[model samples]
Target chain A: MDEKSTINKDSENIERGNNIEVWEDVVNIKDLLLSILICASAAMGGYLIAPDDPQKPLLYGLVGVVIGFLVSSMIIKPKRTLRFEDEEK
Target chain B: MDLSLIMELIAISIFGAVLYTIIGIAPGTDETAVLMPVTLILVLSGLQPISVLAFFISSIVAKKLTDSIPVAIAGIPGGVLSAPMVEHAMVLKNRGLPDVSIRKMASGSVIGTLIAVPLSLFLANLLIPFGETISKYSNEIFFGGAVFLALMTKNRWLALLSIVPFALLIQGLRHLYWGTGAVPEDTTVFTSFFLGITVGPIILKLLELLNKEIRSNLPRRTTNDIVLKQQEKVKGFPNPFKILDKKETGSAAFSSVLGVFTFFMSPAGMTIFLGEVISSRIKDPIKKATRAISSMDGVTNAAYISGILIPLIAIGAPLSPTALGPGMALFNAPPVFTEDHNLHHILSMGDFIVATVIGAVIAISLTYFVTVKYSQQICTFVFKYIPHEALLGVFLALVIMLAYMDAGLINIGGVILIGLVAGVLHRWGVNYGIQFMVLYAAPWIVGNLVF
Candidate 1:
């Protein structure tokens, strides 16, 4: 009975450890670039088709999309920090 | 007004509200995005404009109410409008009052909507003529809006600096197409807005993912316990207005007034400002801040819908992004359709009212059920079942598809490159909103100066 209980405890520890390992492995540079590309392309397309005016919504959206991307990638990503503090760091 | 029409209006309101709620609860969907597709379909249906208006009104209201759920339970905001709710909901969560607070908010919103409808419509009747006069100076209004934006943001100098680049980018693109004056026969002018919204973000994220060894890692959040706890906490009857602590009432009233202006400042932007003002006005910092956030969400949603009535009736423009859905639809419809005489014209007015009313009602109505029955379970289910990488992948595909549809594949490719370039600039802490303001306003500014 003691051995059986010990085995169960061992398995649970393994499971928790695996979960943490999996979580740590998830975020990569490739996924980040893909997101940036998706957003920027969206902005460019927006610039192309929005109501015809200067200070174009599309153009501004493009800038926003790009800014959001770069801040996340160059500054936010480099520090390997989580949360908003990474940007400041 | 019409009894038979009233029934139809209610039906549309209910349907619109449900759809809006669905979109609102789900992250990453915008009000404009949902309304745009529906508007397109309604236009094709050849239904009277009034019917379409009903759908618009109902949908907007529903969206406002349901959007708070995700923000309240998880940290995820429903849309741009529901962003303020995140902070408030977090406070409520920490205090073990998330359910009670949200229920009150839902109630307060409904009451606020009830108050806002007649009041705004009355104001709309009075202010529409003024809107007509002001709209004539679109350029001047744009300038004012830009200045307002500069004042509103963190670091005014940075905001001002951001405007120049946005203007250059917008003007350069427009000139590229029209300057050649070789008008491409079939190229649609409105495609750019759709493209910008869809592609710009996707490209930036894609680049980030590619550079890192890490994959997508989103947080796991659930609201089941909070919701169940809320159910157990409320004893007797639920008074929706209980959420509107004494101070919140005045803040809600004040926010209603701010929402009416047609300047290009985002609804979200104004709400944050209004929230700050209300928080300052109250004596209790905690309640003051929470109420301020609540009132900001309520007023922004109401004012955004109700305020547009002025521009739509007076000038042909609908100032709010949500209202733009119907206005753009109106423009795309037959030109012969008389502005006042058409059913669509009448429905547009009705739509504003319906959206306001339904959004408030549904939000209030659902708060209890959401808090008691499904909030925690639903949240838990989502976190447990949904994978972040899969979610990102799907959204990425959607963003790409939307961009491609807005322009062509070539434009899509160009947008990806542009996003990367823009992302680089963003790292330097450049202001995108100012850039956008410049993009549209620069051409006119330069034209005014040069010509």
Candidate 2:
């Protein structure tokens, strides 16, 4: 009985490792966290290091957000796989 | 006014149109969250006000046109406003007419933009004389709007019950900031709180994932496959009238008028209400669905335009829901635009008209054409390439950065706390419109609360 329960627990762990939905799209939790980390650091880092000029910080932050977005896009593959089907008729 | 300025306006309009068309097709992107950060940045960057107006108008038009693409392509809403059309869009998708659904919706957007622009300008002018009275009672009006929207919600009781507590929570945070000297008493922590509300659901969901029991129990799937039907390419520039039949056009036009009239109401609510009322009598499911989607798209687009335009042209404050949300930057981005000094004060009537015309025309020409011609291809590309992680990352970064900018590090924690509470309220059916109204009326509600 103990052996059987261990096997069941192993199967549940595998299931828990799979993709989960967020904001109407499937995503791996690890990737989500990584992307968030990269982006938050980039954006905040840009904001922090900028000269005290009001516009400079915001502009740098905006650029940082874009950079983070591009980096994340290159690093993380989208969970969705698309398949196309021609019209039968 | 000048040739160089007109040239700059045209260029920015194109930029706005191109940028939003892609963003609009990404599923589940909230209208405000994606639109506001960039707009806020632009405003704070000290760009020309006329140019900003042009960009905003174009962005709205482009976004409205393409947000329905995902609904037609994959049966998921691209934004909150597109959620209402999903049922009807699914109808057409199931009927093997996804392209048709997209074309109809895009055409409907064209009609909406066309009708809404002049009519909104005219209506704004008509109300300009009353702008004084309106701004004087703006706080009371916002409070009343919250109550009215609460009453209209599905869970009216829960929504109504949330108003006072939510108000207290907002004002409580503000008072704390003032007392601790995190910010001056007069410098309201607006932007971060606004971003916090937008990020609420995500924050809640992220926190829930931290619980082992919840994490283990979440339903998981190995493959998240999206099947796209092969669509025949349109050879020429598609005309809006050609895409929509007479009955569809008429209903869309009629709904667009109603959308303008109900400018102060929630666009999503207006879309569902008007879409259903207009299409209820039709017998055929496919026909009914098409009609409904066409008119629904029209209502949202019209409501969006008028929502921003009317309040902007009439009152300098963020009075309407659109103004309060995505268009807030135009009305009240601090140090640049305040309630007292915004587009309404800065731009003349001619400037408004010129900016509106340039933005609307460019967006319609560019986005409408692309939507009819290549919605499937572009949607497939976005789905295949743009990870949800990246989008969510950008959203997260925006909120955190803005929170830090508002009152420093402590305000970040404050924003998250606000997000948690707002997320719970959101999950419980207190809609953004109601929450936003509460945000606007918080100081008033707290100050006027009787012992």
The best candidate in terms of DockQ: 2
TM-score of each: 0.70, 0.86
- Best prediction by lDDT: 2
Question: Candidate 2 lDDT, tens digit per residue, B1-451?
Answer: 8999999999999999999998787655567766877788798888999999999999999999999987886666667688779889988876557778989999999999999999999999999999888878878877887898788777999999999999999999999999999999888887678768767877999899899898888878644556667777788899989889999999999999999988877676678778878998999999999999999999989999999999999877777778877898998888899878899999999999999999999999999998999866676677767787887888788788878888999999999999999899988988766787788889899989956
| Residue pairs with clashing backbones, model 2 | none
Positional deviation of residue B267's Cα in model 2 after best superposition, in angstroms: 3.5
Model 2: lDDT equals 0.85
TM-score of chain A of each: 0.35, 0.76
The candidate 2 chain B region of ten consecutive residues with least summed lDDT is: B221-230
Off by over 4 Å in 2: A1-16, A87-89, B1-5, B22-48, B69-102, B245-247, B272-293, B332-341
Per-residue lDDT tens digits for candidate 2, residues A8-89, read: 3455356447568775567788889999999999999999899998567776886787798889999987766555666324
Question: Tens digit of lDDT per residue, candidate 1, span B372-406?
Answer: 34444544444333333333333343445444545
Give the DockQ (C-alpha) for candidate 2. 0.44
lDDT of each: 0.51, 0.85
